[model samples]
Target: MAIDQEILEVSSMFRLLMKKASQDWNRGACKMNLTFPQVQILYSLNNRGSLKVSELADALNLTSAAITGLTDKLCSLNYVERERATDDRRVVYVKITKEGIHAIDSVKEIYREMMEKMFNQLSKEDIQHLMRIFAQMLVNIDN
Candidate 1:
């Protein structure tokens, strides 16, 4: 195939992959009653511990207002808690609760199932090669 044709095919495949992944993810997330962004916030908090609203917004590439709305819902669900910083009364931090950790564990299982279903046909070596290719693509894009 010509380089242009190859590029078009790759782009098409990438879009299809993303669409399928999103659909699968949505179904899984729906079972847990969480949106993708909500899960992202939970995952971030799980990994990074507590963070300020602005910090979470920056880390997640979302606006502070958006983070606040999401965190509000999360707090209502008892998945996370917002606490005022002791040293700085004006600063608030969001921390994941035990419920949030449980939610993340469930999400991890969903992800594992999704990945297995997606790549079950591929051998271990094939999966490794795919990861390497994706990593290189990311590096190239960064440059």
Candidate 2:
């Protein structure tokens, strides 16, 4: 095959992989009864601990109104709580609840299972090589 043809095939395969990965993630999120943004909020808080609403919005790259809607739903689900800052009542902090932690664990388990199934055929070395290639691709894209 020509070099350009090989590159085209590689790019097509990358897109297919990304599409399937996204589908898998959506499926997992659905099983947890959470929308993608809601799950993202749980994941963010789980990883970053409690954060102000504005900080959460920045972390998720969402508008303040969008974050408020997500947080409202999460609060209704008993997955998170909001607290007013002691010195500044205007500042509200969002914190994950015990239920939220459980959801985060479930998400992690779901991802682990998805990864195990997806790469069951690959050896350790193969995985490392793919990671290196992906890192290089990221660098190339950044430049």
Candidate 3:
């Protein structure tokens, strides 16, 4: 196949896979009264400990306004808290609460189960290869 044709086919397959995965994830998130982005924010905060609003926005590739709105909602849910810097009141940090940590743990469990069901038919070697490919793709995208 031509290179262009190969690209088109691969991209189409990726899009379809992502669509299905997003739907499944959304369903799981709904069970916890969370949206996909809300769960993502929780996970990010869990992994990074705490971050400034701008940093979170950059990490998520979302606008500052969007991040603010999401953070507000998360705050209302008691999943996250905004703290001002003691020395620099101008800087605000977003940190996950104990409840948020618990939420993240719950979401991770759901994600693990979902992945197991999705990849049950794949051999171990195949899954490893897919992981490698995905890591490389992420590196390529970053570059």
Candidate 4:
């Protein structure tokens, strides 16, 4: 079977764009002053709401101890609150406060704008094609 050069070209282009997207996230987000892990926790809370440390760690694929450590740091900074369940009294849940919500909301726009600007550099048709391709990839991964 003959290899398609155009297929290889698009694959390389996808890889390059993915690399650039990751790099741009690291660079522009550092200016926002939150580490990537912190951002992940806050974003998780924003989306999932109150969850125990174990749950958060499970969701993030980190150890419970690591999640406890992260939550402690966030707690000290007043970004999150740890509350013992009234019924269980043994289980504790990490809850996002208004500050944490604010922190998450704070970064949402900058990240979106950064990527939007990058995508805007492409032609509208190219952007639409890329979006559909990535959406299919996501569906494949989810399934």
Candidate number with greatest TM-score? 2
Span of ten consecutive residues with least summed lDDT in model 2 = 28-37
| Per-residue alpha-carbon lDDT of candidate 2 for residues 56-118, written as tens digits (9 for 90 to 100) | 999989988899999998999899999999999999999999999998899889989999989
lDDT (tens digit, per residue) of candidate 1 on 34-94: 9999999999999999999999999999999999999988999899999999999988999
Q: Which residue pairs come into collision in candidate 1?
A: none
Between prediction 2 and prediction 3, which has the larger lDDT?
A: 2
Per-residue lDDT for 13-118 in model 4, tens only? 9899889888888887676567678889999999999998889988999998888888887888788999998999878899999988987887898788887888
For 1-143, candidate 3 gives per-residue lDDT tens digits of: 99999999999999999999989988888888888788878989999999998898899999878888999989998999999999999888999999999999999998998898889999999999999999999999999
The lDDT values for all models are: 0.96, 0.93, 0.91, 0.86
Which ten residues in a row are the worst by lDDT in model 4?
Answer: 28-37
Q: If the candidates were sorted by their TM-score against the true structure, best first, what order would they fall in?
A: 2, 1, 3, 4
TM-score of predicted structure 3: 0.80
Question: What ranges in model 2 sit over 4 Å off?
Answer: none
Better candidate by TM-score, 1 or 2: 2
- Position 86, candidate 3: lDDT: 98
| Model 3 weakest 10-residue run by lDDT | 31-40
lDDT of 4 at 57: 88
RMSD of each: 1.5, 1.3, 2.9, 3.0
